[model samples]
Target chain A: MQTIQTIIGYLYYAIAAVIGIVIVANFVRSRDVRKMLLYAIVLSPFVLRVLRVK
Target chain B: MADSKGNSLVIKIVVVALWLALIIPGGRQLAAHRNYEEAVVLGPGVTEVKKLSDWAPYVANTPNDCSIYVLDSGVPGGSMLVIGGTHPEEPAGVLSAVTIVENVVPTTGKIYVAVRANRSASTVTRPGDAYPQFFNINTDFGKRTFRMGDRWSNPLDSWPDPEVYVHYPSKQLLAYMDVRNLNRTWPGRPDGMITERTTRAFIDMIKAENIDIFVDNHEAELEYSVISTIVAHQAAADVAAMASMMLSAGEFNMGMEFSPTLLHGLSHREVGDHTDAYAFEIEVPEPFLDRVRGITDEALLLEGKDEFVMRAGQAGLLYEKIDENGWNIHERVGRTNSTIDMIVQMFAMFYPDKPITYESLPMRNDIVANGLGHYLLDPAQAEADRVVYE
Candidate 1:
């Protein structure tokens, strides 16, 4: 059971990492200022979570 | 073309810088709060300090494997267990238990106190509630700061909350986040979430220690109906009622209520049903938790003073009364301590054979007069071995 929970925890972090990568890619590609700002706001949490900062 | 490219580069740098500005300090603060430890000076009565995992192995490596302070008299009598920080937002409860650990010594039977019953909850403050990460109390030596925490266990410790929480055994549905609420996860399962396992560890300890009286301390918002009362299980209703009556007649206003039978996840209900112990929960008023509260900060948290809460009382919207004095930390902790004292006194009267007696604990009036800080011992002055971190 502990093993399963650990796996699930890692999976959540992996999902965050994936989302962060996607956001960064989109952020760099997007030319719209409003869209870039929105992406930055959305990406901040994922970045922190992936980094295990929060 | 050159100007357009330059503008794009500048915008990218600005966006990145903004993101860094948002997360850098916030992340650092969160990390510091998570890692900070509160100091506790073990009193003369503390014979041993055991980990919660000592009784239940399932919580051995978890964040909720909190310390259990055992104070045994060696004389044969009844045993009691008092737990605080079941809801970490309630600072008074934690401080009350700390006072017990630092000051009280049982004369007969044994006593076990958990100053931070739900340690994981104490690690994080409520998000977006603007809760102060910590609050400080002045002591004779200097000041002692304690983490001001959230009601539920940190999501970092127990994440991916279920869409709905179906309580074990009873199958009662609770709000999803309550799965991480220590109070709501009583009679917990070993294989369940971290919070559930923590409670299970406590329940195991209760059984192992042969705890005769079980007390869980808490504080509630003035608007909440359960404030300033002792909510007891039917097994402990008589003791609670007598204590409430006596305290109100003598020390302060206190009410008694029966734990609702249908309330599936509460400590007062579940712990009593599952164990031999008579379970009682004491709640004092905390204006900081009220929806009508002003400025969410340490001053409001400790002083419990707020004009907005007073206005709510004026409108008769509050279940508990408050004035300019409000319900300070000292009052809340003192009342809780007194209630615990009264409950044990009444319990002994009903069952002379299982008498749990203790001494040197400051009562409500003493605390109110001299102040709560007077009771808190300076760790710096204490012997190195006598100090423990919670």
Candidate 2:
């Protein structure tokens, strides 16, 4: 159970980092779409957790 | 296009979930710590321990009910009242008074120490500020836990602030939320708000006990101009000046300023004007209270180090100095304790008839060396009758 939890934690961080990089890249590329992407990235985890999709 | 839209929605949902996961538990942890309690070890000098309600019965059984520790020198010359926790978030005030109760042994005059002047405020933490619920200081026996309190009395204790707070007697209009500020409710009314009644009770205690000097302990943000200064009422200006000069020469840097005459509800002003006792308030610099503080946690609260606050100090925006060493808890408490000692000594010199004397209180150098926790006695080791909780 502990090993499983550790693996899950690493996966979570990896996903978060990837999402963060994507949002930042979008922000540098297009100003108009940046806010939308940032908002989506910021809010996505909560929507997933609330819907029990994870 | 549809796939992209779907993906954006999924991302938004995931981010929101992560935010909630962090926030919900973080808030709970903070709330859990808020209930920390500090034990007050009645020292050798404590002759009696009483409740605030004993002076004013109206506050009995209420959350505002606080403890009053009396240290009487058998050969008493004068009586002094030291109030702490007026704004509970200012831990130095409360800690200094607690140190006195735990260490001081009056040899000439009587001393009354109130560790929690506003008990209700100490029970609650500031909202949205992310203030730690509790902090601990290491001691010989073990660590002592103290609640990280709020500036105002908890709304749970006093609800629905008035649209405009009209101070009693003076009828001066103040901010609505100030009704919960004990400092602004000085010379309090018995039939008025809880904070007002608490102050009223203190006034009653002062008058009944014939207190010669009333000292209110406080700490100010580095941004505030009055940091590391003694604000004296008109009557106590001479004593304050003498104390300030002596402290500046002998110990730490300190200044004396007259309390604003027009400032209503403040203890330094109202307590002096209404009562016979000379009133003064001492303020030490606490960088943790600054707006530009980085992390609002126990480490910053105890160590007083914050990068953002230091940056502000570097820019010359702060009235007080701040560095990596920061303004640690010991320094703040040491300044307050030393100032109190200086004030009492000065008062004794000025009015030889009303001489208040006490010893065994650690001075600035001693406190800075030994740390504030060194002066604090472990309540668990104290006699059951001598242990009190604040």
Candidate achieving the largest lDDT: 1
User: What residue runs in model 1 are displaced by over 4 Å at the alpha carbon?
Assistant: none
Candidate 2: chain B TM-score equals 0.92
Model no. 2, DockQ:
0.03
DockQ of each: 0.66, 0.03
Lowest summed lDDT across 10 adjacent residues in model 2 chain B is found at B27-36
TM-score of 2: 0.82
DockQ of 1: 0.66
Candidate 2 lDDT over B292-327, as tens digits, reads 888888888888999999899899999888888989
lDDT of each residue in B42-114, candidate 1, tens digit only: 9988999989999999998778889999999889999999999999999999999999999998899899999
| Least accurate 10 contiguous residues by lDDT in model 1 chain B | B154-163
Query: Residue by residue across A1-54, what tens digits does model 1's lDDT show?
Result: 657877898899999999889999999988888999999999988876777656
lDDT at B182, model 2: 92
